[model samples]
Target: MTTALTLTTGQDQDGAPVLVAAGEIDMSNAERFTAALSEAITDRREPLVVDLTAVEYLDSAGLAALFHHADRIEVVTGPLLSPLLAVSGLADLTTVRTR
Candidate 1:
């Protein structure tokens, strides 16, 4: 069975676009995540902040989706964040800010 990734979009305190991604992001749902992000960027031509605090896991396909839009994406995570990116060796490909 294919799992679905849920993405919630909203604005931050400064009114910047923010996307909250929860659940697992793997081969099963990387394409859906990418499509949602693409739609968000197309709707708002500004930098997008992605909150990964609730993400439990991420795979190579998910990392690729994030890196594909790294130029305009910012990753935010809480303390004790998952080391999915590190395991995938994509820690240098994207900006991950700890909160």
Candidate 2:
């Protein structure tokens, strides 16, 4: 079964779309995560910010969803997930800033 996951949407001070994700993101729940992200994507051309500050884990499937939309997304993450994103080459594909 998929582990617990939560996703919330908001806008940044600059009015850019933001997606805040919490909990583990793995194969089982990657589709849900992708759906949340897709739903949050707005018409604005500005890149979407995916805030991964509360995410505890992320697997390949989870990373793939982010990769698929790398051109339109940036990410805010924490130390726990930094290394994984780095080695997965996601950092190169999209912007990733550790918070």
**Maximum-TM-score candidate:** 2
TM-score of 2: 0.93
Clashes of 1: 0
Per-residue accuracy of model 1 over 1-99 as CA lDDT, tens digit each: 444578999889988888899888898888889998887663556688889888877778888888888888888976645465555545576677877
Q: How accurate is candidate 1 locally (lDDT)?
A: 0.78
lDDT of each: 0.78, 0.92
Q: After superposition, how far is residue 35 of candidate 2 from its true place, in Å?
A: 0.9
Clashing pairs in 1: none
Candidate 1 regions with alpha-carbon error over 4 angstroms: 1-4, 42-46, 79-82, 86-93
**Residue pairs in steric clash, candidate 2?**
none
Show the lowest summed lDDT stretch of 10 residues, model 2.
1-10
- The digit string of per-residue lDDT tens for model 2 on 1-99 reads 444999999999999999999999998889999998888887788999999999998988999999988888999999999999899899999999999
What's the CA RMSD for each of the models?
A: 2.7, 1.5
